[model samples]
Target: MNILLYTWLGSYTDDDIERHIRGMGINCRRIEDTQVCNGDRYHNDEFCRSFEKILEDADYDCVFTTNFLPLIARVCYKKDIPYIAWSYDSPPNLASLEEMDHPTNHIFFFSKDDVEDYRSQGLDTVWHMPLAVDTDKWDAIKTAGRDIDVSLVGRLYSSTLPVLMSRMSAEQQQFFKTLTDLQLKTYDRNILKEFITDGIAQEICRTYEADEDATLRPTRKQLLYSASTYVSHLDRLLLLRVLSKKFDTHLYSTDTEADYKSMLPNVKFHGPVSYEKGMPEVFKSSKVNLCPIFRENVSGIPLRILDVCGCGSFVLSSFCPEVAEYFREGKEAVMYRSAEEAFEKVEYYLKHGDERESIARGGYERVKADFSYDDRIRRMLTQAGVLKK
Candidate 1:
């Protein structure tokens, strides 16, 4: 079978995914030209025409990508070629979910919640498949002998909620503040949607500066995103701050914020590390790799968590329903429900070297057995009917 593997920049698994596809004895044609990944995303008339031309020129049995590309979906639907998309991110950027119901389109999401949402609406084209890892590649990298204690390697998103909050009076501000605190304590779902009514939306809009967006009512999703972004920010901030005080914490991100310096006084902040070279070593060398997932990603296990485990490292992450479901909790990995619990867990794991290493080995074995990229790609292709002769 022949496949056209499309890719975009900033995705972590394009190259390794291609390797796995080819490793399955399939002819995989990789497309990373500026036209596809760098050019028009979706809904551009001329761009769509150009993409159709490219697709027509390179005729293949199927087209695959790291995430769903609506432009490809529409073109593939018209051309009658199967298009398979496996999402690594939760709430995948649903750029124009046009032609979503096409028989030739098989959209896979890592999050069961998202799959349920779409499938519940009678959309059978969607499937729930958790993210996979290329353990062989990570296993090849050499470790640096557990130099770091606790580490988090990602961006620290600053929320826009403060901007909206700035527009409100003290009373309204207090209400939203309390709501945020309560919402932060909650898990798995976006609690902001429950309270952001149309009247409240109007009040927020009234206070919101017209120059910013001129819109009257903020959508529930918009409010959820703002609050979630801030919540994610606070989540990571709190985790790192607490962990730093007790352990030799390190952060490998582009977060140069002044507040982070004062907040995490004992933490070491290093520059961003690439997904390929630097990360595996960091993961192997770190005693406890921190993975505080963005709360907006409701149920999907983030790719970073898989990568960390794939590298044979111990990860102490926030409580993700899917993570707990897939791996053995105390045996393969450790899950913490709250910041206080996270600190306590880290404290225990750091002192107990043998237990920590045993958990890491178990996690590595579990990931290798159940989360191999080669097996996942084959499963996706088979289900999509691309491999049906």
Candidate 2:
């Protein structure tokens, strides 16, 4: 089967995905259009016209992308080709799902909650597929040694927090604080939504200077969820600060100028690393990879946890039911309910080298055996009816 792999800047998994697709004996050609792919001019007619021009010459069975691209979906629908999108982001903007009802679109989300919600809306092509890793690339990475005791490789979301909080009133701020406190303590289910009343949500939207016309903007629930994610970012910053005090914690992100940097002076901060080259080494060299999942992700496992496991490194991730559903908690991976619990596990696993290595081995084997990109893409193709089972 022939596939057109659409890619853009900051596509963490595209290279590995393209390699794995070719390894499966599929004819996969990759195309990069920075304009539309970066989301800067995604909806522009110029981008769509340019993209269509490229597609006109290439004969392919299907089009594939890492995330939902509406323009591509429209073009594929016109061409009578299936447009398959594997969404790795949690709670992908509701606008993207506007095309869920499109007959030629096959959209896969990492979050089961999202899939169920869309399915309930009568979008049968929407499926729940958890994120996967390229085990071969991760397994081949070699590091000098495990120098870092604990490491986190992700964004600080520093820009999102202040902007969100600035728009909230004092009452709204207090409500949000209370809600996030409860959410940080609770796991398995999202309790933040329970705390949101329509009145409170409306007030928040008003305070945030949102568009007066409800039809032109995101719903109050989406606004509230966005705020809660800011809270989750704060929680991550706090956890890193606390952990850095006691453990040799290392942070790798481009967000170094955030206010949290001043407080985390002792914490080791490294500039951003490319996914294909540098990220695997960070996982390999860290005694424990810390995965503080975004607060918005209720039950979905973050890709970081899977990537760390693929690197054969011990991962201590925040509580996510999906993690437990896929791997033995204490054997293949470790889960923590709170920041304190995460720190405690970090200390325990650091001292117990043999147990940590065993769990890492188990995680690596599990991912290699069942969660590789080759396996995931083949399944996606079959579901899209491009490949016969």
Candidate 3:
């Protein structure tokens, strides 16, 4: 079967996703809608037009894209080719009026809650299918170790950081105190309050600001009823920084380069490396991979966990709902509830290489069995009726 993937294919995920589908013997073509200048996608008119040209030229039985490029899916829909989109996280665009602007007949969603939301909006054309990693590219490799304790490799969401900062006022403090005290019954609220009351939230906002030079220090927040992804974000950052005092730590993201260098001087900051060339080696070298996400509405596991596990390294991530659903703690991977927990877990794994290696092998096996890219695409295609079941 011929498949056209309408994606911004410069990043690690998009490239690996296409590579996995093609390896399954499907005639897959990539229509990248963005230009990577200095390791970032420049989404201008020229980039969109270039992507459209590629889509127009490619002959394919179906098209699979994320909601980021609904226009390509619209083109496929108009051409009468089956278009199936895999929305990795929440369907922000698909849930918006823009979704109706160029509505698709077939859209696959990762979050079940999102599926219900779409259904309520009278869009019955939705299916639940989570995103998977390309095990081939992300799998563990046996390389001479790079000295790093913990690392995180995702974008810095500036949008949410201000919301976290906004709650620092005396007026907002009362509201936060009440809400947190109420939440203390179920979760860790004291730690949550320190992040809010101690001006840590504002510091988080200041930390993400890029220097005038944009390279001197890499810096890299939340919501309330809004969405406090900062607690989760800072949790990872603080955990890594604390670890750096004892062991070498590194970060591999562009958004956080300035933050890492300024706030985490001892921490090695390797700004976004090419997945094709650098990520595999980086993942292979690191002793343990950290997936630190403290977002309020996070769904599906972070891609980094899969990337590290697939690369054959032990993964240490937060013990969230999705992580628990996919992996058995201490068996497939290690999990922690707080920075204290993360420190304990990392220290334990680092000391016992055999235990870490055992967990890593189990993680790789689990991903190969259930979370590989080929398996996800095949299942998605079959569900969309683009291929025989």
Backbone clashes, each candidate: 0, 0, 19
Model 2 deviation from native, Cα RMSD in Å: 3.0
CA RMSD per model (angstroms): 2.5, 3.0, 7.7
Q: Give residue 335's error in model 2 in angstroms.
A: 0.7
Q: Is candidate 2 or candidate 3 better by lDDT?
A: 2
Which of candidates 1 and 2 is the stronger one according to lDDT? 1
Who wins the lDDT comparison?
1
**lDDT of prediction 2:** 0.81
Using TM-score as the yardstick, the better of models 1 and 3 is 1
Q: Give the alpha carbon lDDT tens digit for every residue of 1-389 in model 1.
A: 78988885547878888888888898988877545656666666776787688777865889998888777888889889899998887776664456688889899999988898688767889998888888889888997599988988998888878877776768778878987888677775566656766677666677765546544456555666788789888888888887888789899999967778888888898888888889888999899998888877878888888998899999888888999899999888888878899989998998999999999999999999999887788788889887653
Location of the lowest summed lDDT over 10 successive residues in candidate 1: 209-218
lDDT of 3 at 369: 79
**Model 1 C-alpha RMSD to native:** 2.5
Inter-residue clash pairs, candidate 1:
none
Worst 10 residues of 3 by lDDT: 213-222
Which residue segments of model 2 deviate by more than 4 Å?
37-43, 94-96, 159-170, 196-200, 206-218
lDDT of 2 by residue, 42-105 (tens): 3567777777787888888999998888888877887789899998888775553555677899
> On a 0 to 100 scale, what is the lDDT of residue 220 in model 3?
17
**TM-score, prediction 3:** 0.73
